[model samples]
Target: MIRQTGATLTGSREKVLQAAAEMIAEDMGTNLSVRAVAARAGVSTGSLRFHFPTQRELREAVLRRIYGRLVSDDPILDRSVPPRDRLVSCLRQVLAPAGVGAEARRTWTRAYEAFLVPEPTEQVRDAYLAYEREGLRRMEYWLTVLADEGALPRGDHTRAVHFLRTVLNGLSLERAMPADDQILKTETETLFTAVDAVLGPATT
Candidate 1:
């Protein structure tokens, strides 16, 4: 009976996690809630509570799961690609979601309205901070790997990570706004400049 109970618990936990991930991907997690996730998972609230115990725990678990998925397919780990190229590719990947034309504008509009325009509530602020911290952590990891491989000079990469993030943020916004083909041309130039600034101008 105990073994069966354990299996049931594990199954419910997996279902809850998967449901949360799907919600997050679908609507940027705007409607995430224990009740919503429980419904989506086809599990009782008691099961979600049993596995997650707290909302914070559930949120963190979902974020970690999302990042884990990204890490599994991350180009930063592709050693055959030169570090500079890999970094540039990673930056482009970050901007890729902004898309172009109507899709990019819609993404930008939703993001601005959600977290920018009016003052964000405490929960909104916390969610944004969580995502920002995760982004910084990912940037640090990429730079650390390059440094360990002698592709980058060893040093504190905090500023470099922040700089890269800032550049990407600006580029992401730019991608959504109206611009000529020159914006497309300059986007690559901008990425290279940011990468070179961080990695010191790619080895010959």
Candidate 2:
């Protein structure tokens, strides 16, 4: 058995996840070696490998952890909030640029990029599919709640969800590029305006 070092031996699974997340955020998509992660976490390589034997396993764990942080358990699907407003909030949270700090942005960018890569392994593929499905499910949930509350002008929840997901994905890619603040703001506003034109305005 691999011996854990320092206080990590007593640390929960969440601690391992935090260490991995910090590493990914700091490094972006580069140098995600098990040895590196072990060193960063103050644990033996064997211990890290014992917990996650394969690279894919560790990547999937990190993906799930980040998803959990991004997606709320009690999502604001309340019918009281107009569907458009709810959708905007959801998209903004999903696509907001990493942040002011280089580390924060780099971490988020790495995590997001990892999710986009098409892994050949069956387990990796399954995990990716699960992530995609969960995203769609969230969109569907928002659309359904809004439709029920008479927020959507037309209630094709499935179609609306699909369209919104596509748009969000496209916008996310665009926002990932290096652009001036004014250009970024204009592009984001234009995209949101287009979405609003289709989805209708959010009522205060």
Candidate 3:
């Protein structure tokens, strides 16, 4: 009876997590409330609360789930590829979803309107932070993998990850703006430079 009850609780938690992941994928800033997720999962608010307890816990759980799906087949795990090449591919993948030209512009425009133009509510702010934290987590993981393979020196990667992410964010924003063919060339050059700096002589 205890095992059966535990299984039911686990099932309920997975359902709620799936609902939250769907909501996050649909929109980063909205549709993450307990009420909304419970309705989507076809579960009771009380059940979600019993499992997650706080908004932070719910968001973190959903972020991990989403990140797992995003990077489950990541090339970083493919030792056949040169570590530098793998890292470049990883960086480019960050901008792939945003598209280019008009599509990128639209993506950035929507983000500005949602989180920048108006003061974001508490929930919106929390959701945004969750995404940022997840990004950092991913960067750290990539750096660790490289270090494990002796392609990178093992040390605190916090600042290096932050720098890489900042560069990627800038490049992502640049994609939304008007630019010529030179931009693409420069973007690749920029990634190479960042990776070179972070990985030092190892990548060469």
Q: TM-score of each candidate?
A: 0.84, 0.54, 0.87
CA lDDT for candidate 1:
0.81
Put the candidates in lDDT order, highest first. 3, 1, 2
Give the winner by lDDT: 1 or 2: 1
What RMSD does each model have against the real structure? 2.6, 6.5, 2.5
Writing each residue's lDDT as its tens digit, candidate 3 over 41-109 gives 998898899999988889988888877776677888889988888888888877777877899998887
Location of the lowest summed lDDT over 10 successive residues in candidate 2: 96-105
Best by lDDT: 3
Q: Write the per-residue lDDT of candidate 2 for residues 1-204, one digit (tens) a residue.
A: 655565665463455667888975664443347777777777677777777887667766776677667765434565466555556676676655444335445644666565556445564455456456667776677666655666665455667677777887666655556656675577567656855765665543
lDDT tens readout by residue for model 1, 113-155: 6678656777677667767777888889899989989988788
164: Cα error in model 1, Å:
1.0
Q: What local lDDT score does residue 55 receive in model 2, on the 0 to 100 scale?
A: 66
In what order do the candidates fall by TM-score, top score first?
A: 3, 1, 2
Model 1 residue 174 CA deviation in Å = 0.4
Candidate 3 Cα deviation (angstroms), residue 102: 1.9
- 153, model 1: CA deviation in Å? 3.9
Candidate 3 segments whose C-alpha is farther than 4 A from its true place: 1-11, 201-204
